[model samples]
Target: MTVVEADGSFVEPFVTKNLYINSGETYSVLVKADQNSSRNYWITTNAIKAHHDFVQAPPPISDRVIVLLNTQNLINGYPHWSGNNRSLSLPHTPYLIALKYNVTEAFDQNPPPDTNDIESYDIYDVSENKNAISSNSIYRIGFNTTVDFILQNANTVKPNHSETHTWHMHGQEFWILGYGSGKFDKVHDTKSYNLINPIMRNTVPLYPYGWTALRFRADNPGVWLFHCHIEFHFYMGMGIVFEAGLEKVGTLPTSIMGCGKTKDMIRP
Candidate 1:
């Protein structure tokens, strides 16, 4: 197939047999079905990958760089996925309501660290990870600030291997700068970023024992979610919350109320 567009935007055409279409992702491709017209051909929509060629997106520069460690450990005796050594324990109150109402008590302020603290962690090692903790944390970003995010995939507690995950972000699209295998070397890897025409996407895949880099501008208002798109993985706590420019936002629609503290805002 000759690929032409990604996520609804046209790209410099490229050819490949395997394609990694992450969740919330769309592509337009041209397949030459000239071969074997006598029999039906099977089309693969599963995940693999091919780098894109063009898109109007943020340059490969950012005001801040946040490295997120993707790992798993036993949280309360069950295997759980986590980011930056913390599994997200969301509060009953939707984060948008909590942030808008200044309800400090509604959610924990524990934001996932921007960097991984585990020194010399082996990506292939299947040993038990003991440093993880669960919390109702969320991240606050300065509106319009550009951020470069690097995802480092790591080993888990029970499985003798790491797993690939499809990461999705709400409220904004990001420029996928590049992807790498093994531990990410900030100094060396930064040079490989595609500054010319990196594609814009809301979701991308993190290869097992590999890394994926993305850059986005937090120009949107309100709270957004950044998480593993896999249903089971997200349920296992592989995600984080983001809030930016809330002061600029006006009253949310009344339809958004009636949960947690918002119940009071929606009276009879």
Candidate 2:
């Protein structure tokens, strides 16, 4: 049996029996949703619970590129790094958040929304990394180097925990830029954020309940993973892909036209 909201977004409703809640008992409940199906469900002691507020969908993962963000346990004391039943081999980034993406439309102009976006977290850098990309080709870090992303808060009942959210990347280091806490704006664009001096690093922090911008070069080519560092948040589905150093393949003269980048690493 499952509990569901009146609107039917989640699987289960808010009744006492529907939500496996023990009054006065402070216990952590593991909330879950279906990764493949539209029916969102959570696991409980008595049965597999469902709710209407939550949506069951697969988190976003871009095969063309790889993105990894550490959301859930950013602090040094989290179990992902210190406890016996450790969750991660590497230290979680400064912040973590849940996210989702469509396999087909992930790179499209408009994307779907999840509960985590109601308030976004982000960070940016402007300093360029000299060794960010190793390549034989000559590409300057002038206009060719820039990175930015946006987050949408579609949830009405945003989580009431920390007001700050941080985001970080993996593999190639990037420069910090600027960030905001609203929808995409054209006038206040972050395309040329810190066009002056740029910092370099693989990880950047995104603020809670807001959006962030960044700039980097597509110098490295390979499959790099980008997702929320928070194991729980990552499991919740906040991730993306970045494909740099991709080599473009030519098509035959017959008509089987095709174009793609080489999946090889390029360092300057």
Question: Which candidate number would show the highest lDDT if scored against the true structure?
Answer: 1
Clashes of 2: 83
lDDT of 1 by residue, 93-195 (tens): 8888888888888888756678875457777786445556887888889999998889999887755688989999999899998998888888888899898
lDDT of 2 by residue, 1-268 (tens): 3344433244433334344454333332233453778666654565345553443221121112111222333233321211111122221211111011112221222222212222132322211211111111111112223444443221111233223333455656555555555443435654435555555555655554354555555455433455456555444334443444333222213222121111111212
Q: Please give the range of 10 consecutive residues that has the lowest summed lDDT in model 2.
A: 93-102
RMSD of each: 8.7, 21.9
Q: After superposition, how far is residue 181 of candidate 1 from its true place, in Å?
A: 0.7
- lDDT agreement with native, every candidate: 0.84, 0.34
RMSD (Cα, Å) of model 1: 8.7
For model 2, state the Cα shift of residue 193 in Å: 2.5
User: Where does model 2 exceed 4 Å of error?
Assistant: 1-147, 151-164, 189-192, 246-268
